[model samples]
Target: MPEYITLTIDGARIRVIEGTSVLDAALDHGICIPHLCHMRGVPDIGVCRLCLVEVVENGRSKITTSCTLGAKEGMVIRAHTEKILKLRRNVAELLVAEAPNSRAIQDIAVRCGVTEVRYPFHHANCVLCGRCVRVCSEVWQSKVLGFVGRGKDRHVALPFNERPEYCKRCWSCIDVCPMTITPCDGPMKEGEEYLCGKCASQLTMIENSPDSCVWCRLGEGFQCSRWRP
Candidate 1:
């Protein structure tokens, strides 16, 4: 028999299999926790920091990424508190500022209640979500892709900056990349980046019910687990 653990999320008691991450458990029960850099069946690195949740203990709370947080018996978690929403909104804003062209990032920003971006746009090409590198190494076991360099120079690249002949050419890396899906209006020009709030209306459902899954179209091609059939 499989062992199970019960945890409290947003005042609701949830029972889940032992060792399941809090993010997965909440998502399984239709609780929304926005995230990127997490792929089903792959080990979570918690790089995106989007699935953050507060764990209550000793009359206080500690914030951590739910994707890396294991479910334990009697655990108390708060996924949508005002503090969390504010921080998550800021994180989503930074993501959009970093890559305003990604429809996925734009949708996530709207879902996080970002009406404006406070930071200057870097307009960088990648957000370093590591989806491609993880998918290649963990899913395909190819290990052909990796992040090299350091600081701002860091980025994903083929080993030795060259594609080896043994490469499968599966292109699974590209399929899972968030950058592949540009904004509906196409690429933004230099110094012309702006938050795509066209889907802002969808946030109405989230506002009314913070914890319920509205099945917002935001996750369509972003492969958000909540959007899965």
Candidate 2:
């Protein structure tokens, strides 16, 4: 016999299979919870802490990670409360501050209503979400890349911190890594089009340089980087 459980997310009642996480349940209902480290058909570690939600029990509300919290019978969930929004904003701001070069983080900051960061920007390259590490070890089964150090020194590194001879040459790690994306806010007129992150940053390299279609990261993905016809 199959088991199902009924739960309420933001006042919308839904029934889902037992053991389904609240994040998946909400997503199944077209409710998007802000998240960074979630990938479908892959294991969720709940390390991003972006999909935080409130679960109400006995008239008391508590914050929990939705990707790990399973939906149970009569569970009441609030995905976007004021407190949750504030927390999410803070998280988004911090992420943006660390990797302001990532268009993904910038867009997420906008979505989370984060305009500025209070903390000092570290200008780091990797947010250390471990998406690439897990993908390589789990889906690709290559284990070519793994964490190199502990705490602040920790980072994704190739086996022995050097390229392996048995490497499959598949760039799946780059494709799965969120930091690899350099999205451009686009569809600009004439010269403004095709201003990808790499292309846009070129302005700092050379003064009074005209913007052109560098066909950067977004273009490589075949994403929209051209003007509307």
Candidate 3:
């Protein structure tokens, strides 16, 4: 077992294992922290920034991402302070303008009480949470999807904006995406040489290699035949 550390969240004292994120601690203690693009089994990209919390240390409050930041002893975390709430509302508004068609974005905006967007809508319809990129790189281990352009054009896609021939027809990228920018087209028919089910064209390169089962890898220190059976 790992060492557990005590921390204060919104003035509530709690103990959690070391390396545990503040968001995880909050969830464990029945504290609600608003977030998006954060799945339990996925990597913490922290691109949404909706889980920002105010941490008071040495008599000062600062905003930080709870998903990426681990809890430490004597740290005071304020999850739903006025300042943090206002920031969250503003961030929600920005996301709404970008993805006006997304119900998830609209629902989050409503929850944050953001009725209108004050900032100029310069960003595209994408929130750029990088969930697609993270799923492709971390979970699938395929370097296919990436940020092609810079600044406002910094959207996730294949290299050189051209599809690769090494794709393996895995839809992991589409399955784990937070934003619904990528549509789910049906699988290819029998006549097609390589059939792409869902967004398999976007993340098929990962299946090029034979990977072992994740559970067996951690359970017995090697690939277990039980998973195959």
Candidate 1 residues 139-221, lDDT tens each? 88899999998998999998788998867899999988888899988899879999888875777788887787788878568
For model 3, give the 10-residue run with minimal summed lDDT: 216-225
The lDDT for every candidate, in the order shown, is 0.88, 0.69, 0.62
In candidate 2, what are the lDDT values of residues 1-229, reduced to their tens digit?
A: 6699999998889999988888878776766576777665567888878889999999999998898888899999998788998998898888876766566666556556665667666656788988787878788788888888898998989976688976677877787666776556532233222213344343333223111222222223422212112
Clashes of each: 0, 0, 2
lDDT (Cα, tens digit) per residue for candidate 3, span 20-84: 88887876675656567665555687888888999887898888899898888777899877788
How do the predictions measure up, each by TM-score? 0.96, 0.77, 0.71
Highest lDDT, which number? Answer: 1
Ranking by lDDT: 1, 2, 3
Candidate 2 has its poorest 10 consecutive residues by lDDT at: 209-218
Task: Please say which candidate is ahead in lDDT: 1 or 3.
Answer: 1
Model 2: which residue pairs collide? none
Score candidate 3 by lDDT: 0.62
For residue 76, model 3's alpha carbon misses the true position, in angstroms, by 1.2
Q: Which ten residues in a row have the lowest lDDT in candidate 1?
A: 219-228
